[model samples]
Target: MKLLFNLLAFTALIFTTAANADISENSLAPQKEANFAQNYLDRFMQRDFDYVMSLIDTEVAGTISPEKLEEMHGYLPSGKLLSTELIGSQVKVINDNWEGSFTFEYHFEDGWALASAYMIRTEGKISIAGFSVYNTPDSQKELNRFSLSNKPLGHYLVLTMAIIFPVFILVTLVTCIRTPVQKRKWLWILFILFSVGAIKLNWTTGAYHIKLFSFQLFGGGAVSASEHAPLILTAGFPLGAIIFWFKRRSLIGQKKKTQKSQTELKESDNSV
Candidate 1:
């Protein structure tokens, strides 16, 4: 049992490492798009409208004057650009070219801003298609952080279920290890290790995403999309555990019956 568990752990580690490597390498293509978006945001923050406009496609640039662009920046968060973070990116291929949006977060001492740069590649030249910047005060960001206070009633209910599910799964697991089964006992152990559905809850928002059919290693967990994001609670139904509990009595009965029959056979042979 120990060897089997160690093997499973090693295999899982290798697969997870490989998947992470692939994701890191696959992001290179989008890095160029991300850089372009960052450049546009820098120019906008510097009030260098001409430089920003130069990045836009010619036809689109003609539609808005630099003065109008400056006016659009009214009430925008103003502070020394302390740091910029690339928070989101998506690209779609068109023929051989790609169009995408790269979103960035600009953090300041008292406020923050989200700037999304939408760009398109055509005839081998990249140009901005559209852009948006939303300025938000730091207090709003604080309200969104992971915290126990001010949460909705649904959040607590979901959290309670998430906690309960994992505990139930673990208790069933321990019971199965101690219980006796007639045959292929190892197979039952393996089955009891998995949960067979997914329920994901956004800890910050009272939202849930559920999949009726899915395989999860653990019954429940918590994670965050990014370092700064609020926690997300994920859980699955302990189908294996439930089944094991239901069949446990039958397994124990079978084992006892097998032992009794063996004793009777020995007694009959001795009499003969």
Candidate 2:
């Protein structure tokens, strides 16, 4: 009985080991495809057109000539390849044909990167199926620095003034029409003129080119001369409005005080 039980246990262990080995090999299959896809992409980006075309599917290669492929690469963004990393991949098997695709992020100098690659397999051999270039977000380090830099200050100034001045004009127009204070109306007109100056600046820089059609404005995001202008313009409206509000209130207070004193003096004189 002891011998039989030991034999059974040994057989089960061998089966388990074989099953685990098979599972590991199956799981690693996709990773292998992904690596091949990355390699194909690297070769193409390096301008090794012959080597890349050799690995492509025969049918696909027939459709894309060597000259057309070179032309496509010529239009790609001008930058040195920094690095490439495989992000994800997909594989499918249908009717004896294997299709595999890999997505990779290609990082480049000057905060440039794109994610695009695909691989396919025919008769158990992997080959480059497709390639795409999609824009990726700027790195946080560069985005923060450029968005805050003083160069884009004018862009921000134009954007802020563009957004706020319209509301400022509306409020001013309403006040001028409804109020009897002609003196204050002129001051409001001056504010309107200041707003107009901002609009003009924005127009010259093409701020409305984006904000007019789409509410999503890049403002002064890119590295440019007016990068810091956005920051200043962001604060300009509220600060200017607050200061003007207080000054107008004080003027109104003084006017009322003068009128009250004059009335009291006339009453005293009449009684006398």
Deviation (Å) of 89 in candidate 2: 1.5
Tens-place lDDT digits, model 1, residues 2-24: 64455446545643453233222
What ranges in model 2 sit over 4 Å off? Answer: 1-29, 134-272
- Score residue 107 of candidate 2 by CA lDDT: 65
Candidate number achieving the greatest TM-score relative to the actual structure: 1
Candidate number achieving the greatest lDDT relative to the actual structure: 1
Clashes of each: 0, 13
Error of 2 at 99 (Å): 0.8
Residue by residue across 152-268, what tens digits does model 2's lDDT show? 565666655544544443444444334444255676545433321112232223343322221211111121222212112211233333445556656566767777899999999
Which residue pairs in model 1 clash with each other?
none
Positional deviation of 164 in candidate 1, in angstroms? 3.0
Q: Candidate 2 at 164: error in angstroms?
A: 33
* Candidate 1 ranges with C-alpha deviation above 4 Å: 1-32, 57-71, 90-100, 122-124, 139-144
